[model samples]
Target: MKRLRTSIRVKLTIATLIPLVTAIALCWVVGASIITSRFSSQALYTVETSLNSAHELFLGEQSRLSDIIRLTSRLPELAENLSTSGPTASVAPLRLLLGNEHLSFLTLVDRNGLVRYRAANPSFNGDSRIGDKIVSAALKGAVTSGITVLQAEQAGRENPQLPGKMVIRLKATPHAYTSSKTMEERGLFLVASAPVLGSDGKLLGAVYGGILINSDNRLVDRITSVVFQQGDTDARVRGNATMFLDNIRIATTVRDEQDKPAIGSLMSEEVFAAISRGTKWIGRAFVLKEHYFTAYEPLRDLAGAVVGALYVGMPERPLMQLRSQVNIIFSCVLLFLTIIGVTLSAWIGSKMTRPVRALADGARRITAGEDLPDIHVDSHDEIAELADEFNIMKHRLAIREDENRALNHTLEQKVMERTAQLEEKNQQLLAAQKELAESERLAAVGMLASGVAHEINNPLAIIRGNAELLEMTATLDNPANEEVETIIRQTDRIERIVRNLLTFSRSGIKRLSLVSLGILVDDILDQVGHQIPLDQYRIVRNYRDGEIEVEGDEGQLRQVFTNLIVNGLQAMEGGGMLTVETSLNMAQQQANITITDSGPGISAEQREKIFTPFFTTKRDGTGLGLAISYGIVTDHAGEIRINGEVGTGAVFTVVLPLRQKEVDELS
Candidate 1:
């Protein structure tokens, strides 16, 4: 056992080395982490910035195309030639402008989008371009310019060399989804179209010109020169740019193993997905079998559809090499410091542990039942002071050991008594909280009732008085008389609602009277049309053979049933059945009233809090109707329950004793 254990000097040496080595290791880890994160962040930012530049350059080209077409369409000589002479007469000026602008095709179309003059092939000029977005937009007096795709036949008709120039054989690529297509024949173009209006602003025709993108590396090479120009020779080719028609590359500076531009290669599947969704992808991606920090942004046509993508990528190898160099230098420096620290720590531990060894020897002797005197040391420092204090501690420790035994016993008893007292106090506190909540709820109801009654009564009185005077003066045959009666009726309904609110605020049933559930339901049903339009709802009633009477405060009971009926009507908002069923339980001498609504029923979690004060699912509910009804029913020695499941609708059932005498007897 002793052989397995290490000495204090060894422990101190290891402790000193642990933190020093840990701190050095942590420093290396943090440095490497920061460097790696910074490199990644900077790489993405650079590629994204390059992508922005490419987009601007692409837009600038489109703007230049639009400018050329605009200038050509507005020329007086060309317009006059087309308006007076044959279509062939205008072909001379169009051909001159098309060659000067280096455009692949230039043509003039009539107001119906029919080709009238073709600068490239004047004889082939009767096709309709009305189906094309650019042509359609321009013919409607708009000057539109953007990327657009042309079919192979259309390109062939415009220029005999275009179909051959647009053909590109697809090449297999790593990290790209395999496609069955072997060749891309559609031509992607930067096109601009403008309306050719006459001197009087009349639509005479339209003019459009474009440059083919497939097999043309000029645009992508220009983007590379502008974006990667600041870098060295090696870095110049490290950053590449590409233009893709969908996922297939039409033009690119990215080269394959043969050092040829990989124009027909497909983009990585992940990048294709992002571009397809009209979003930008910025991260590390494998392009042409080499990893690069790349950014791909969707290229949209004039119709705002994602027809292709634009990409810019920077090589990740250079940044990774820099990070490797930094790590190598950092590790070497830390290794040198660690070697020096280990040597110094061993020497210091040996010197400091000599006195400590002596103390250990003394303790061992005491443990072996041998009496020893005070420990002494030669050094006049804290180590020497420690020896004197150690002797005093040995003497005081014996006396304190006995005192602790008694103190521990007394502490356990006090803890038990305090725990019992805390449990009792907790119970009292819980009871107090419940009472306080109820009191606060009552106080809020009283305040709301007082404020509402004060604010609405004066205005209601004025309205009612004016309505009565109008009712007296209006003739029986007057159409407005019916509207006047409706106003007076609604005013009375508002007064009754206010009275009910004041009663609910009191939180009790003040008087008891006989209420016929069947008759009461019918009366409220007849009056509910004033509350809400009932054209969409179907009312259903199933009453017992005789009237079922209950002894309750008539006004309070009326409020309860009215609230339920109105709630049922509101719930079936899209037009469903509102069912009122009343039955007498002869065995229990209780009357049962049920109001069912074909509405989306309440869930279990909602049912738990359905009758809680200020809890409601309605958007604009005050959340007190059910709570008030619950209180009134309980005061009358009655029970109210809700039964239903989600999607089946809810049924609210209220059961009351047949008479007040029966309720008293049961209580």
Candidate 2:
């Protein structure tokens, strides 16, 4: 404290070390950040690309099966055998092809959607596949292929070996959705179907085959081979590929602690939920007992419903090891450079001390107002350069001061722009919330309808049963006979209404059959008198020369046509003409049934919402009739069209496909 003398060398040393240490720290921090970001990005990209590759492989399997089935269906000999001797004669050729193609199951179905032959079990035949989506589509002249989940019984029916292979023991998994079952007995298959057509272009039948994917490692191994290309002896260092049926791993290349394929292990709940919502999940996730960078894409059915997921993941350990190595190398380099910097700073500080003392002495002389010659340094050094740079630094500092003010002004404008963007985001959030609310409302409605239908069905069945007993017990000429009959009829109507509600809620068709549209319309017309007062209205029928038949659920089609006919009759409150016409569009192989009502028509807005559930114009209407009808027609691969303006009366047209064969006696 005598004078607090600080040497120029000390000052110069501090100045040199301050910026050197700061720069080294910055380089370390920035370099680590860049390394981590690049590695993470590359990891994510690799996982996503692997997922895409796995998806293509899955599709490639389906395409291969599709080609096989399509080519098999085009065989003239198979078609001739099917048409002449039926599935019995065609089995030999099919069995040979089945073995050649390595299919787990191959079936021949007639145009009526009935399984006529089974390559796996020749004795098992004549089972109806009318409810099978792939077979039904194939019968309708479409070649179809997709990943399908089959019930254990259905899989066993295809091939007895399939059930055993499909059975996977479920293991306890972390962060996965829990299942009530201990094992997944159902089979997941890559299935393909094609229509067997005659030389004249007529649909003869359909041929369908499938390869079971449960416990199959070939596809996932192929995906890994193609995507990773690195044949590592260590399984942990290799990539993982999995195909999930919902949340269950039906096919996978990932292994468990026992070194067996984790076939039945479940995926994380977060990934499952994301894929369930039809969104891709790409990020780090915990798989099994380890963390991994994963990418998952939803695997959809032919109907576009998210049925499962395709997943690819890289082990986090390898990536972490790489990052750790990079960091270690950086740290070592940083430490070495730090040591060198300190040594150089010490040397430079010693060199500058002499020159700095000379400058100090000159400054003191100038301050004392002593006239002196220009200060001279013997060597060209940093101190000599600093003397020349002082005036330029002063000018640049002023320019930076002005730039700071302009930057502040620009930042304020940017804040305003950001505020506007935030407002727009808020508006988007509100819209999304509104959509969510609407979805919730629809879900609630479905639950209510289902509950109501269930609660009403038991009492309804009892009432209808008692009413039928009373009708049967009473004499035909008795005074109470008509009343009993009416009671039974009215109870039946209530049952149909309940059925409509149940169908609308579940959106399912119970059974499929060949229905004659003309006969169905006539039957509804004959029965309409009991339900509606048709005394004031004139009904006209314009049916084709012959009955037009279509493949559908008879009861569902009855409901659809009855609803349309009844709606047409009721629309004419003032007693107008109701016309029903049926025709065939041979080119499209479709039947068109048109119902025209000569009364007030539907408005454009109402028409748009007409098929939507719970939207009705009538005061006493349940608003589920058209909705149920629409679902039924769509399930049957048909459509309902309304073509009429306000005040012009509504014309309802129902288009349905013609059945290629008689499906009534298929069973």
Candidate 3:
């Protein structure tokens, strides 16, 4: 084991594995810490928020109940009539009133602590605690209120011998009629109670009402339903929430899978204790055999006593799923970073080792006095530069070796040539001198063509300008309009021909200037407009919405466009469309202008030499048009290309750089 560990391969493996393992371990530790802290904080915040919302909802329910009570109390006639009428007559009107108010039961009691009237079905006979807490308190002239839990089974048994059964009970305090009685003997009921007062500010009687909290699970279920819906389903209440009075469960909105009620179940001890403190609590706890993040807030009565609690919660499955997804993404990122680091380290190590090996080999060759070969290295870093310097040193040694070989060869030749050679060498030198003169003569003739082209260009420009001025000023109504226009047009054509000649002769301006392509196109079109039949050809312009400026000579570019457009018009003897489009080129800081013509396109064989000087297909054509255009554009550091198909016509694309100043500012 020790020997295996000490091996170089094992050591290298350990070195690589140790760091990667350490990094992965650290990533997991950090990720877990963050996840735990953030998840706990988010859970706590969610619990607190839900508790607050439940408290507000409970308070709203109390306020709604109070509003209904107040509305009932305003009917002083009903209270007065209930005190005077018999039990049967009073029961019908009271039942109607209770039904309208959405109360489960309504009752009226006398001051003697007896139930005089009851609105609910299945009579109580005033046997229960009819005038209990509320009645006693009201008799003493104190407004009394309290909520009570009523079991449907127990309450129903009281009326099992009657025609129908009552599923709930109600009780009131300080009976309606005036009588002497102790508060304890009033036989008050186990339900909510309220005092019925008269306008004279005297205690008229009491009105008691009770709702089967267990039967009204719909309200709590609706409150606990999720506010937002996802996927294809609507939001729903997923978990149970039970209202607890003191330590006992009063009612619950929980339902089984079959939609059967799961009420009357004992409340959890932890949740009960939390509510008893009169402070809100929330955390992961089991509800209906499933774990959830449950929120509980104490419900307070008018006197600020803890009467019950409102509970709301949701399952933690969604949060667990989210945590799993985050872990997967983190793992992927770590793996990607690890791969990149390994690749970079290996590449750098190889890069450092290769040059050192080459440098050592070159040094040995130089020491041996052998002709050294060139070494090539391709990095713009310090190590590459060092290798470059070493190569230079090797090159110097190789030159020295060559010179020594030449000197040795000369010495041997000298010994052999001593007898007879001087006369023959002089005759050979004369023949070489004669050949050099002939080459110089041909070079002089080429220079003459450029000079002649320059001399002719100036005269042509002068004649063209005068002819244009005359045509512009001349009246069109004159009988000589056709003749004069022809002269002007022909002069412009001659000037274009001369400009091409100058380009072929290599005698035009060498300076680049900012020239707007839009203006250049307009000038070229104007010069060649009359030459082409207007009725036969259609010209289309698709220029972009700005000045298309480039660095080139305006006159030379105008000559280029003039030649292209005229050739396009002549190609389609039957006439066709000539489309010119312009836009900016992204990578090349230049303007791209393309001219396409719907004419018989160039054949593949003719396309190759189309830009060669003096290569024409027409009898009267000088064929210098495209060639000179190509040369002039090339001189401006621009590119021109021709794309054509046998049947689909041709497209010529010219790309010229923007002026240096514009390019610099844009950059």
Which candidate number maximizes lDDT? 1
- Tens digit of per-residue lDDT, candidate 1, span 1-667: 4568787667877888789878988888898889889998988999999999999988888899999988888977555655763455456778898788789999888887778888877778778889888888889988889888888898888887799999999999999978999999998999998988889888887889899999898999889889877555443348889999989999998877777888899999988988889999999987878789999999987779999999999888887787898789878988887788778878877877888888888888867867788887888888888888888877776578778868898899899999999999999999999999999897787656644453344335545654665767746566557656756665665665566556554654356667888888897787666557789999999996568788876655766787788888877768899999999898999899999999998899998998886687888676777777787787778989899999999999999988775332111
Query: Candidate 2's C-alpha lDDT?
Result: 0.80
- lDDT (Cα atoms) of all candidates against the true structure: 0.81, 0.80, 0.61
All candidates: TM-score: 0.57, 0.52, 0.44
Output the better candidate (1/2) by TM-score: 1
lDDT of 2 by residue, 585-620 (tens): 999999999999998999999999998867888887
Clash pairs, candidate 2, are none
Q: Which scores better on TM-score, 2 or 3?
A: 2
Ranking by TM-score: 1, 2, 3
What is the number of residue pairs that collide in model 2?
A: 0
Error in Å for residue 613 of model 2: 59
- Per-candidate Cα RMSD to the true structure, in Å, reads 11.7, 28.7, 23.0
